[model samples]
Target: EPEVTQTPSHQVTQMGQEVILRCVPISNHLYFYWYRQILGQKVEFLVSFYNNEISEKSEIFDDQFSVERPDGSNFTLKIRSTKLEDSAMYFCASTGTGSPEAFFGQGTRLTVV
Candidate 1:
């Protein structure tokens, strides 16, 4: 079965540096989402995109963050300036519909120093 894949499994960066987390969502899915889980915290939705534009975004998705579908299969999340609070496990998910059963990638661990 086709599954979502994320690169660099882990990343460590200093504050203020930029980082781009990569993901390849399930091929046939039309809805893509970014969610983050701080240690010991529940998963929080960051953003959702479809048809090449943002469909919905949470307050967590501030000016420092952006997302892109650079190619047919690659989706990326860029943080313009990292902060210690930004360190978390970022999960890429995809679903054919806006359902709670969306599939998740293993997750990319981002550590902002």
Candidate 2:
């Protein structure tokens, strides 16, 4: 079975710096998304990208946040300026055209100090 893969399973960032999180989804998947969990909180959706463009985004996906598929094979999320409150475990997920379930990556834990 194929699965989503995220790099740098753990990361540390400064309160005022920028960060880019990377992910590669299963080759046959048709949709991709980003979700985050702030410590013990519930998972929250950030954005969804499809057909080379953003399809949907949650309110949390503010101007400071952006995503890209700079390369045909990888998807990335970039946070312009990190804040202590921005620390969270980011997960990359994907699903096939008719699949009802999304397969998630192990998650990249981000810590802002």
Candidate 3:
């Protein structure tokens, strides 16, 4: 079975730096999402993308955060400016039929210092 794949398992950046996290979701999935988890906190939804546009988003997705599918196979999340609070394990997920189950990647851990 195909699963979501994320690159550069971990990243470290400066407070004001820009960071791009990449993910290759399941090929047949139509719904793509980006979620984050602070070290010991609950998982939070950031945004969901479908049909080449944002389908839904949470308040956590602000001006500083943007997501795109530059290619049919890859989805990317770009953080314009990093902040300490932005550090978290970012998960890339996808679902084929909008079912309750979503496949997720291992996550890219970001650390802003």
Candidate 4:
């Protein structure tokens, strides 16, 4: 079965540095999402992309955060400036058209010092 894949399963960065988290969602899925879970906290939705535009976004997705589907097979999240609070396990997920259920990737753990 196809699953979402993320690169650099773990990343360490200095505060104020930039980080780009990459993901490849299931091939046939039409909707993609980015979510983050701060250590010991509930999962939080960051943004959703469809048809090459942001379909929705949460307040956490601020000026420092951006999402892009640079090509058919790749989705990415970029943090322009990392902060201590930005350290978290960021997840990439997707769903087929009309499906409420989402398949998630293992997540990329970002550690900022």
Candidate 5:
């Protein structure tokens, strides 16, 4: 079975720096999403993309966060001016057109200092 893959299992950045977390979702999946778990907290939704546009986004997805399908197979999440509170495990997920269950990537652990 195909699965979402993320680059750089871990990353560390300064509080005011920027970072791009990359992901390659399942080839056949259409809906892509970005979720984050702040340590022991629940997984929170950041944004969702479909048809090359943002279909939905949570308040947590402020101007500091952005997502793009820069290419046919790759989806990316970029955080600008990172904050210490931004440290978390970011997960990339996707689901097929008719499926409600999403397959998640291993996750990129972002540690903002």
Candidate 6:
């Protein structure tokens, strides 16, 4: 079965630095989303993109963050300036609709120093 894939399973960056986390969502999926989880917190939705534009975004998606579908398969999240609070596991997920069973990539662990 096809699956979502993420690169650099773990990343460490200094505060105020920029980082681009990459993901390749499932080929036939329609909706794409990014969610993050702090060490002991609940998974928080960051943004959801579809039809090449943002469909829904949470308050946590601030000016420092942006997402892009650079190609047919690749989706990327760029943090203009990282902060220590940004340290978390960023999961790339996709589903055909807004259902509870979205498939998530293993995730990219971001550790801001």
Cα lDDT tens digits, model 1, 2-112, are 899998799999999999999999988888999999999999999999999999999999999999998999889999999999999999999975555788999999999
lDDT string, candidate 5, 8-107, tens digits: 8999999999999999999999999999999989999999999999999999999999999999999999998999999999999999988799999999
Backbone steric clashes in candidate 2, count: 0
lDDT of 5: 0.96
Per-residue lDDT of candidate 6, residues 1-113 (tens digit): 87999987999999999999999998888889999999999999999999998999999999999999989999999999999999999999999755657889999999999
TM-score ranking from best candidate downward: 5, 4, 3, 2, 1, 6
Candidate 1 residues lying further than 4 Å off, grouped into runs, are 97-100
Please give the distance, in angstroms, between residue 42's alpha carbon in candidate 3 and its true position after superposition. 0.4
Best of the two (4, 6) by TM-score: 4
Span of ten consecutive residues with least summed lDDT in model 4: 97-106
Q: Whole-model Cα lDDT per candidate? A: 0.94, 0.93, 0.96, 0.97, 0.96, 0.94
Error at 50, model 3, angstroms: 0.3
Worst-scoring 10-residue span by lDDT in model 6:
94-103
- Where is model 2 poorest over a 10-residue stretch in terms of lDDT? 94-103
- lDDT, candidate 4, 42-84, per-residue tens: 9999999999999999999999999999999999999999999
State each model's C-alpha RMSD to the native.
1.4, 0.8, 0.9, 0.7, 0.6, 1.5
**Which of candidates 3 and 6 is the stronger one according to TM-score?**
3
Task: Provide TM-scores for the models.
Answer: 0.95, 0.96, 0.97, 0.98, 0.98, 0.95
lDDT by residue for model 3 (1-113), tens: 78899987999999999999999999989999999999999999999999999999999999999999999899999999999999999999999885769999999999999
Q: In each prediction, how many residue pairs overlap at the backbone (N, C-alpha, C within less than 3 A)?
A: 0, 0, 0, 0, 0, 0
